[model samples]
Target: MSTWMVTGGAGYIGSHVVEAFRAQGIGVVVVDDLSSGHEAFVPADVPFVRTDVQDREAVAAALDEHRVQGVVHLAGFKYAGVSVTRPLHTYTQNVTGTVALLQAMADAGTTDIVFSSSAAVYGTPTVDLVTETTPTLPESPYGESKLVGEWLLRDQARALEGTSTPLRHTSLRYFNVVGSGHDHLYDTSPHNLFPLVLDALVQGRTPTVFGTDYPTPDGTCVRDYVHVADLATSHVAAARALEGGHDLAPVYNLGSGDGVSVRQIMSAVASVTGTPFTPQEAPRRPGDPARIVASGELAARDLDWQMRHTLEQMVESAWRARQAAEAATP
Candidate 1:
């Protein structure tokens, strides 16, 4: 069996990927520091190392010890606003950490990688539906760091690939990742839109909606929200594609193929929670695009990717998980 190393496997999306891989009876070793990830999310049977991905030596040791054949690089700081506040930290975590991971992979003779990229790379796209050929003009450090990471992977792949060894990689660009598991592992980030709304609804407080008068159909910002499970499926598919000797570290967008306005999401949340909560409108957030939808054509054709979850399903699952989490709290 091919052993795999999943960085940030204890994180929200990473944990889902870990579960999916285990369900398929694939060997997986997780490396996480629990900074943004939760240890409780990590599976008990899978081998885990509590270490940073930037620690090259530690990562190398983990790779060698786990006999890793490939890596699903999912470790990175993803908060867009926070990245604006701490650009250096974002670069260090997203870019520098990836550099260290690639070096460690090279050292361990692990050549395959599937990177967890984001839609933030297409900052303020001029086109409504973003494609693989869309220009990458990231507005914040978070997106910039991911773009830089992609460049680094491409460069390293070019430098290392030959007859003896080959470096193959795939970067999956995920849109807004919503939804939660049955186990109640909700998102820890207070910055995410879904969690923020859920938290406010749980507290009987009004959720804040930024920019109500955008150019979108609902007069609010629109985004392509992809279910977390769909995103996780793309990751595994990307890994399997690379393991099959696919060359070039191509980028693929993961979205629902349709855009949902903020108002639509708010309505869905209210319907799911059975609460008539109104949103407090505010000025637009910096670096936020008016409307951002993606064409999942590449993902569909290449990885056989199709989102099985809808926005309603995502909202309902999130509400269920949030209620479960709150009920469990002391």
Candidate 2:
């Protein structure tokens, strides 16, 4: 069986990608620093290396040991708002981390990579629906770092154009990734909207909606939320496409093209959790886009991407998982 290395595989999205790969009968070796990932999230049977992606020697060793065919790079600092306050940290984790991982791949002669990028690359987009052709105007250090990560992949590939081990790469720019494909694996992100709302309700606290003065119809931030599982499916597809010698766009947006506002998400949380409480409004957060929705036409055409889960389903599953997590907590 061909094994692939998944950086941040113990993380919420990375864990789901691990599961998706396992479901497809693919072998996986997980490498995570556990800074934000949970060791329990990884399956006991799968191989795991507890280290940061910046540890090029350790990552290269793992790749060689496991005979990894490719890599799904998802390990990095992901908080857009927090990145504004900690630019250096963001660049170190996202940019320097990517550089180290790419270096490790070169060492191990692993040529294929699927980068887990964010929609933040197209910061506060001007178009109604973002596409692959959209201009990249990163507003935060996190966004800028992700863009630089993509550039690294392209530049590395270009440098190895005539080499024995030519790099094959793709970056999947995800919008708001939510929902629980499995109740056992829910999002635990403190900065993410879904987890924040769910955590508030779980603790009998009112969920606070940050920024109600955005330039959207609801006067709140609008985002294109995609189910985490659906998003994971495309990561695997991208990996397979590269391994199969199939050409793909350097970047693909895994967006819904359907805008959902914070108020709407609050409403969904209220309805799904059977807790009808108005969310407390707050000032607009730093580095938050007023609205961002993107067309997944490119990914759908190439990587079998589609919105399989509805908004209602997303909230319901997340609530279910949150409850499960609470019950399991000591």
- Against the hidden reference, what TM-scores do the models get? 0.97, 0.99
Q: Write candidate 2's Cα lDDT for 36-116 as tens digits.
A: 999999999999999999999999999999999999999999999999999999999999999999999999999999999
- Over 4 Å off in model 1, which ranges? 247-249
lDDT string, candidate 1, 27-103, tens digits: 99999998989888888899999999999999999899888889999999988877888999999999999999999
Q: Would you give me the overall lDDT of model 2?
A: 0.95
lDDT scores of the candidates, listed in order: 0.86, 0.95
Least lDDT summed over 10 consecutive residues: which range in candidate 1?
Answer: 181-190
Query: Considering summed lDDT, which 10 consecutive residues are worst modelled in model 2?
Result: 181-190
Please list the residue runs of candidate 2 whose C-alpha ends up more than 4 Å from where it truly belongs after superposition: none
